[model samples]
Every structure is written in C-alpha cells, then in structure tokens.
Target: MGRRPMPVGTYGKIRVESSGPKRYRARCRYRDFNGKVYDVERMGTSRTNAENNLKAAIRDWVTPVAGATVTASTRFRDVAARWLAELVRDAEREFRSWGTIDTYRNRLEGLVLPAVGDLRMNELSTPILDALCKKVRDNSSASSAKTVRAVLSGVCAYAVRHGALDANPAREITRLESKRAKNRPQKSRALTAVEVLDLLKRLDQDERAAKDDLPDLVRFFLGTGERTGEALGAHWPDFNAEARELAMSGNVIRVRGRGRIVNRGKT
Candidate 1:
C-alpha cells in the first residue's frame, strides 16, 4: 500500500533540531491548497520557538488553488472581474436583474477599480476601504459613494468566500452621508390643479414636446401614477379599454452592451 498523503492546506510531523549554539530549526512537509506538497522550515532561538514559528508560517501561508481564479495575492481588478462574471451568471440564472449587474459593472469600472484595482486582496483593510469611500463621497455625490461602497462590499465578500480574505473589510466602513441632502432640505408639496393644467397646456403648445409625444406620456403618468420607465414599457396588450385598466408589468431600462430592454417591473 502507498503512504497516505497529507490533506491539502495542512502539514505533517514537525521536526525540530539544533542548528547552531542557540539556534533551532523546525521542518515539515506541507501540502498546500493547490494539493502540492513541499518541504517547509522556520528558524528560531529555541526548540519550542522554532516549532511555533513553523506553525505560524504554516497558518499564514497562502497559495493559489489549482484552478481557482482568486487568491490572497491576486489583484483587486482580477477578483472584480471574477465577481462580475459571477454576477452575469446570476443574471442569466434569473437570480439577479441585468440592470443591477450593469450598475455594479459601471461603478466598478468608473470608481472602485480605478481606486483599488492594482491592490492585492490581502491589502484591502477596513481603514483603506473607509478612506476610499470617504474620498469618493467628498469628490462625488453621496449616491455614487453608496454605490461604490456596495460594490466593494460585494467584491470583498466574494474574496472571503474564495478564501482570499478572513473577513469582509468593507463591512466595517462607516455609513456614507449625503452632503447635498444635509445642506439642502427637501420640501414636499403637491402641484395645484391649476398648475397641473397650465403644465399640460404648455406641453400641448410646444412643438418639440408634441412631436416627441410627451403630452400623452405625461397624461399617462398623471392618470396611472406609474414611473417613467413603467409608463414607457406599457404596451397596447397591457391595457384593457373594456376594464379601463393598465397592467404595470414591465419597466424600460438601458442595459450596457444590450441597449434598451424591457424588464419585469420593480414592484
């Protein structure tokens, strides 16, 4: 019978020996995550210290999986690409919407990747993520910062699942605050009936608005109270004149690479 091999990511039978007057060395055969075994050793001033050092080294050691796309040393950009691929797969499986996938990809390419793409997975600490998000919030709008934060959280969570990280650092980032919202308080008031009629009259008088069918679209919105996308996605089949009802079953959205598409309504 052949000798049994050590399990992957584990080591066997540490041996410690004196190397010099006060120096000691510990050695073992470690099977890495890739299922390859290698002789590993670590030195210390004493026997116990040497063994502990070797154990610590074994604990901290990281190697790429045989066919995995992510590792501790893999760049953030590479991991983001893998994560994006997973998102696309999710969209195909109907677990996620194509619109959501598009939003994530746009944020990754425009903001998250540009800031941290070159960094290694192990380098993404909580402080670094916090700083990155804060910088984005200061430079861009709060909505953009929120999107960036969400994207980072997804990427780091994926890293954790792939064994590239211990925990998701983005989770520790502080909540993003909207400076615009803080500076400008929103006032809520509905338009008067006269104002609404005046607006409709202006839409009816404008040649460009008339040519673009904005008046009818605005009328549909006023009558159904549906979102612009939902109203645009409405088809003749969705409306029943006998029942005087319109089914809000789809939403119009522009998807990257696929252009405009009608998807199931948000509600």
Candidate 2:
C-alpha cells in the first residue's frame, strides 16, 4: 500500500534580546525537547525582519508534519546506530561496501549523535534536519550534506516501513539542489594517419628531454593500457597464467569517487 503524504504548515516563533538596544540582534531559534535553543539564523536587523526570519524558520521546522511533536529528547542516537547495524546485516555483498557502511557510520557517529543523539526517533523534525544540513554545507562539501540526507532518509524510511512512525521526517526536508554546470564542447582526440605520423615525429624529438623512466613507463602503459594511477598501483600477482589476463581493484584504485566499483577479491 502507498503511504499518504504528511501535513505541512507555517509555524510561528518566539524571540528575545538583551538590553533593549535599538540595534537588536534578532535570531530565529528552535526549542528542543530538553528546552535548549537551536538557532537558524536567517538573521535580520529589524525586529520585524527578525520575527519574519524566526517564523520562517519555524515554518520550515514544523510544517512538514501533520501533528508530530518535535524535540531534542525525541531523537535517539542508539536507534541510529541500531539501524546502521541492521543495514550492515541485511546488505548483500554487491549492495554493501566498506565505503557505504562507513557512510552510515559517519552519519550516526559524526552528525546525528552530536545533536539530539539521546532523544527518540519520533522527535526528529524538518527544521532540525535543515539546520544540520546548513551547518554541514558551511564547512563541508555539498556531497557530504547529501550523504547525510541519504542516511537520514534510510533511517526515517525504516521507521515508516516498520510502523514505528507515520512518515519519514526526511521526506519533508528539501535538498539543497546543486547548480548544474554548463556543458562545454570537448576537444576530440581522434587523429588521422598523417596527424599520427606528425605526433610520432614530435615524440621522437620530445624523447631527448624525456625522463630516464619514460621508456619503461611507456612500455608498461602500452602493454597494460592502464591509466597513470592504475599503472602505478598494479602488482605482479594480478597476472594469471592460464587466462593470460590482468586484474585490477577499483576501490583500491580510485578516480573521482562519484560511484562505487564492482568488488573483486582482495589481494
């Protein structure tokens, strides 16, 4: 059965300041289960601006839920750990990797546990998620914030699947969408026979200034057709006698880490 969407609304906020100075430092803050203040500084100089900021923060915090109570006491760090443990258990070899589990662990140990870690799962809210993502974005990569969202989504989705919660709190928090890079025309590498002959002639001259290791390096590159890093990382054991093949470990030899490599047996 499909789950129904949760109710969302605008929430009002409360603000206070010291000394009643004309120049008031107005903040948009959230109160948690333990009665502690969590600030969301969509800051403003004027009281009206501050109030608006606070109310907007509040709306962001509470509007996602139909009528759920949010508080610091509500999120339990232990529960997150438990869920991660379960993730490790249920994951298949292809589906699970050291990196993936490490991601789950990082979310629990690094972010969630540090804030509202002691509370029950029912207490998590969109505002809290928003604040956490905002903080991470300030000091960390956009990808890291997105990782946090994925972990949170898993935990919240688990809660919904188990009937422990009505809906995933993570579903309401909007992701900070990354800006798309404008596509540029790529320079083509295809060369004609005449161009290849020219390149060979240039290389013959270029060989004079080439490093002492260049000949061996170029020979290894020609034999293996491996990239610079892969060529450097390869070992003698990777070659097979019967199959006449060479093996490479992708995780062991990383490029840009946007995706995972298929697992081959460890060396």
Best by TM-score: 1
Against the true structure, candidate 1 has what lDDT?
0.86
lDDT of 1 by residue, 1-267 (tens): 999888888889999999898899999999987788888888999999999989877776755445667877789999999989999888767677778888889989988888899998877789998998899889987788888999999999998888788789999899998874546667888888999999999999999999999999999988888888888889898789999988777788898888888866344
Candidate 2 Cα misplacement greater than 4 A, ranges: 1-75, 177-250, 253-267
> Against the hidden reference, what TM-scores do the models get?
0.70, 0.45
lDDT of 2 by residue, 189-215 (tens): 856678756755665567563544554
So what's the TM-score on candidate 1? 0.70
Give each model's clash number: 0, 11
Relative to the unseen true structure, what is the Cα RMSD of model 2? 13.3
CA shift of 229, model 2, Å: 8.9
Residue 209, candidate 1: Cα error in Å is 4.2
